[model samples]
Target: MNHQTTTIDLIRHGEPEGGPKFRGSQDDPLSVLGWQQMRSAIQDEDQWDVIVTSPLLRCIEFATEVAKQRNVPLHVEDRLREVNFGAWEGKTTAEVIAAEGNKLSRFWEDPVANTPPGGETIIDFNQRVVEGWQHWRDQLAGQRALVVCHGGVIRMILADVMGIPLQKSFGAVSVPFACRSRIRVDQSDFGTLTSLHSHG
Candidate 1:
């Protein structure tokens, strides 16, 4: 069997209209600056064969614009959406910390073990993101693809590619707004993290 190399560029959505909150599953649109930030992040690149994005507004809006501009196919993938934060969905970190105290700290320390009150568990989130990633990898083999998604989604994908334990992945990866990460997978299905760039 001939294996082909696949290149995937993952980018976190820019700032949403809602400023600095948990934001998971909130469906907030991007702010004006968020639009500018995303535009600048891809201004120099136009080599994608396809664009895949989370269904959330923050990711899809920009993905739609870019796909139309470049004439590439765009796919809105629900599996790539940010992990549902449940009770913490719209609350700030400070708010969560104040309300949950040590619980928040424990969660940060070991998310796989300490899930948020109503949030998706780290294991489940990783599984879904990886499933989506594998589906694209197989479907778009040998092509360069762009994925516009959330910080959490990017982190989980990176962790999977790098063999980082899920328990350590949450804090181990820092995906700032408009951050771009590239992964190249060889015919053997081995993935390499080629580069990471952050607009901020």
Candidate 2:
């Protein structure tokens, strides 16, 4: 088979209206700054064949706007949503430490072995995100695509593409709000991650 290349732009959704907290599974919409951030991040990109986004409001809202403005097809993927933080949802780190203590710390340090109470396990979350990545990678082969997703999801995808171990994936790279990453998918279905950019 001839080699085909697919270019995918992974964009983390802008800041949510809610202040810093475990936003996993939280449906907060984008704040004013969030809208500005997404708008700015995409300003440089001229076009895309398709736009995909997490089902969460934080990602989908801006993705919908972009899809409409750019006249691109939009797809909502639940697997791309942020890992559900369970009881930690909407709680700050201090509060979580006061509540779960070592378990939360363990989760922070070694996500694969440690899991937050009532939250999705890192292994499961990685599998889910991988499925989404594979689906899109195959579908968008030989085309340029954009995905609006969460920081965790973006990190997971990047780790998979770069062969980074799951334990080191969480902080291996920083995926700031409205950050954009580029990935190239070759004909063999392997992904190579390149470029880290943020909106001004």
Candidate 3:
């Protein structure tokens, strides 16, 4: 179906406590507030045609509950998973900072050629997620959708959609646990996007 318009509710999963050093790939459950955050977003909304979730349990914990309420089919997509931090998964942010120092900060500040040590590059990540989203956009056509995913992925989507440069995309946007960002995906000859924000 040619989807002329699609509403894609992009949501970031709940937060977690400081676990020594946190990095990508390590698994952690959402905090209590995280559940509360998800509750606020899902309970307030009554209808959703489909609910897609990240493969990680962090997002699944709250997403499962949302699906149960709306009786929406839950599909797990791996592409939405956070960037793989490889060996740095369990280390605390401080630990990684201390070990990598300026380089780590530089990666956060400017991930152009810099990348997480033993982790996926930002360019590859952007392409992976955008391609994944495009595939789904084609499938959804004229429909509303809800997807639960990670923070980094959400920022990447917003950055790409809003034309925000990835190097400076790590700004600490205060997103409450399980908070929802409702965006309408407009389809046109230019492709799917929101005119309100273009990728910077």
Candidate 4:
């Protein structure tokens, strides 16, 4: 039996205009440095056959540029957007800590259990991301693809692909700005994390 393989590279958007904060669903554009960081991350790599990105401006803007430069197909996937933080949207860590006390820490410890008030639950977020990932994986099978998305989105997909417990995903994976992770899936739908890179 011949086994088909699919390659995917997941890249998190860099710093946004508001700097570091709970940027979920905020739709902020990338900062100047964010653009530089993203460019630097992919400067040496342009082997993708297609580029998929979140609907958010931060991911789409850069994805668009790269797709055009590489002359590849570009897709904007809504499910690839970051988790919605609801009441915590657009707030800094210090602000959230001051307002909600240890809730932030607890949420970090186990996002599946301690959801931010009014935020999207980890279960729901994971489901959507997995669905989106499956769609892309199947749609672009046997091709190398790049997914430009948010940190939370990448973490959830990575957890699903690698069998990392959803509760432990936050602590197990660290997806900083412009970080890139590669996944290769075989004909049996088994995925392996091939490599992970963090760009400065």
Candidate 5:
């Protein structure tokens, strides 16, 4: 059996405009520095068959431009959005601490069991992202593509690709703003990491 290889680059969106906060599902544009970081990470010679990105402004804003410039197809993937923080949207850790007290800490320590009120559970989020990844892997088989998405979404996908336990998925990988992780998918639908946790 001949195994086909497909390369996918997962890029975390640049810093958001709003100051530090849970910003999940809280659509915000990228900061000026965010744009610069993205531009710096990619180059004109970079080749991609398609550009897949989250619908959020931070991810789409730059993705739109890149796709246009490269004349490649751009796909807005909803599942690529960040983990929904529910009621905690747009609230800083300090603020959440002041109001919810230790709940915030508990969530951080064990997010799978301690999901935020009305927020997405780690299991649900992981399932959704994994489905999305598998769908794309099949659709873009043997093609090189760029996936621009959120920190949480990227981490979840990385965990899925790396076979990390769902319970320890979050924070298992630290994806800084504009960071890039490369994944190679084989004929068996398994992914191998070529490069990871790079701030490019």
Candidate 6:
């Protein structure tokens, strides 16, 4: 898994003050334990070729620390940003449920077709994320890279690559804040296992 062609360690930034609650885009900095989580996630591993981040402040702060600790350049990719929660940006899940009632319950089933009040659709998210991956694939051919992104993006990547039904995306693993997901993609040979290969 170390020949080259990148073993992208996609990491979701730590939880900010309004995390696991509202706070979707816009701007929100990491909390105290969030910073600790970021430090712990990459402290033991310092061999990444490059550190890329989402434009969000939460991700940027953590990515900056990792870049400094590992002595690598920090690059920002807007497409790596989280799904815009729109009207729900600052509301709790329960609030959404109470507001939309039964309709809200179906969000997980057809988010691609449904719009979240004033937020981006699932289809839009998929498009942008894939675009981001392609951009990096071109630049990081035969190299290693580290990508900092959001929990939803990571879950989408896992769901799309693993062939999970789009409706079941919410069933993806519990992504701990600032944790690492090391995926090694091989261009020379294409296979599902190629994405699972990891060295660090």
**Could you give candidate 1's per-residue lDDT for residues 1-200 as a string of tens digits?**
55577788899999999788998888899999999989999865559999999999999999999999999999989999998888888898999989888987787678899988888999999999999988997788889999999998988888877788888888888888998888887774454333333322
Which prediction has more favorable lDDT, 2 or 3?
2
Compared with the true structure, what per-residue lDDT tens digits does model 3 show for residues 105-169?
Answer: 77667765777778888888888877777677667767777878876787777776678887776
Residue runs of model 4 more than 4 Å from their true location after superposition: 188-200
lDDT of 6: 0.75
Better of 4 and 6 by lDDT: 4
Residue-level lDDT of model 5, residues 28-94, one tens digit each, is 9999999998998887677899999999999999999999998999999898889999989999889
**Candidate 6 residue-wise lDDT, 9-62, digit = tens:** 888888787656656686888888788777778747458778888999889988
Please, what is the whole-model Cα lDDT of each candidate in the order they appear? Answer: 0.86, 0.84, 0.71, 0.88, 0.84, 0.75
Error of 5 at 185 (Å): 1.4
Off by over 4 Å in 1: 1-3, 188-200
Predicted structure with the largest lDDT when compared to the true one? 4
Error of 1 at 47 (Å): 0.7
How well does model 1 score by local distance difference test? 0.86
Query: Model 2 — TM-score against the truth?
Result: 0.89
* Pairs that clash in candidate 5: none
- Tell me the TM-score of each prediction against the true structure: 0.91, 0.89, 0.83, 0.92, 0.90, 0.86
- Worst-scoring 10-residue span by lDDT in model 1: 191-200
The clash number for model 5 is 0
Cα misplacement distance, residue 15 of candidate 1 (Å)? 0.5
**Model 5 weakest 10-residue run by lDDT:** 191-200
Worst 10 residues of 4 by lDDT: 191-200
